[model samples]
Target: LVQTWKDDSSIFAHDGRLNTPYSDHLLGSKYCIHAKGFEVNTARVGDSLYYGCVPVILADQYDLPFMDILNWRAFSVVVTASDIPNLKKILQEISPQEYSVLQANVLKVRRHFQWH
Candidate 1:
C-alpha cells in the first residue's frame, strides 16, 4: 500500500516526508482511518472524534469503547479487516447525504470520546 500511494498527491501516506503536524492532518481530513495495530485497542478512534473526523475503523472482532451507550454506526464507519482490499469501494459507496449525517453525528458524539 505504501508503494501504491507513494506518488499519489491526494494521500498523506506519512513516509516521513509528510512532516505536517498530526493535529493538522486530523483536522483537515473528513475521515480518519483507524487501522488496527498489534493490539486491537487503539487511541485512533477517540482521536478522530476529538478532531471531528469521522473514523473508518478497520478492525475485526474488536470492541469499540462505550458500545452499550453509543451507537457507533451513527457516527463512524466500521469495516472488517478482511475488507481492506475493498476499502476504497466501500467508502465511495457511502452517499454524500449519508456522509453528512455521519459527520454531523461525529460532532454530536465528540464529547463522549474525550477525557474531559
Candidate 2:
C-alpha cells in the first residue's frame, strides 16, 4: 500500500482524479505511517492524533515530541530503519487486545498534541 501511494504521482499531483484530502485519508486509516523527513519533527504526528489513528513511526534515531513526559510506546509503534522489512510481521504480532489498549491510550494523549 505504501509503495502504491509513492508510485502514484497523481495522488499528490495537482490534476489527479483521486486527489483526496489528507485529513480524509487519515480519518479512514487505522494506522498512519510517520516517516522521517528533513526536520526531526513533523505535523504528521499531531495529525494522526487528531484523527484517532495509531502512529507507526519509521525513523531511526529520531526523538519524538514530549518524550520526557509522554510514554510513546503506549500509543505508537516505533520501527527502526533496518526493521522496515519486518513491519508487517511486527504489526501482526500485536494482538487485538493489545491494539485496543494502544488505541485507547492514543485517545488519552490526544489533548497533549492539541494547541491552544
Candidate 3:
C-alpha cells in the first residue's frame, strides 16, 4: 500500500489512531516519495534518509542537499515531474540488489542529515 501525508485537507487530518508515527512509517517503508514543497527543498528528503527509507525525489530541476559532497543516486531515486506517470514502472525495474545498495547508502549518509 502506498501511504502519503498531506495536511491541506482537514478531513484527512489524523485524529491519532490511524496515524503511524512518522518515524515508524519511515522505518517500515521501503521507499519514501519526496516532492518539492513551497521551497525548493523540503525536510521530507532528510527524514527519509534519517530512517533509511530510500527517497524517490519527484522534483524537476530542484537542487538537492549536499550535491557536491554526496552522490544522491547512491542513496535515492530522482524522477522528473514529467516522468511521474512512469514512476511505478521505474521503481519496479530496480533490482532487489540495487535497492539493497540504495538502502545501505542511506544508512551511511544518515548522519549527514542529522543536526549536531
Best by TM-score: 1
User: Tens-digit lDDT track for model 1 on 1-116?
Assistant: 56655686765555454567788999998888876776445466788888989888888876778889989899989989789888778888999999999999999988877775
Return the clash pairs for model 3, or none: none
Estimate, for each residue in 1-116, the C-alpha lDDT of model 3 and write its tens digit.
12322443311223345555778877877888776766445577788888889998887877877889999989999988889777777888999999999999999998888865
Clashes of each: 0, 0, 0
lDDT of 3 at 96: 100
lDDT of 2: 0.79
Task: Indicate the worst ten consecutive residues by lDDT in candidate 1.
Answer: 10-19
Per-residue lDDT of model 2, residues 2-37, tens digit only? 563556543321223446788887787777777777
| Worst 10-residue lDDT window, candidate 2 | 9-18
User: What ranges in model 2 sit over 4 Å off?
Assistant: 4-18
Cα RMSD of all models vs. native, in order, equals: 2.0, 4.4, 5.6
Please tell me which model should have the higher TM-score, number 1 or number 3. Answer: 1
Whole-model lDDT, model 1: 0.81
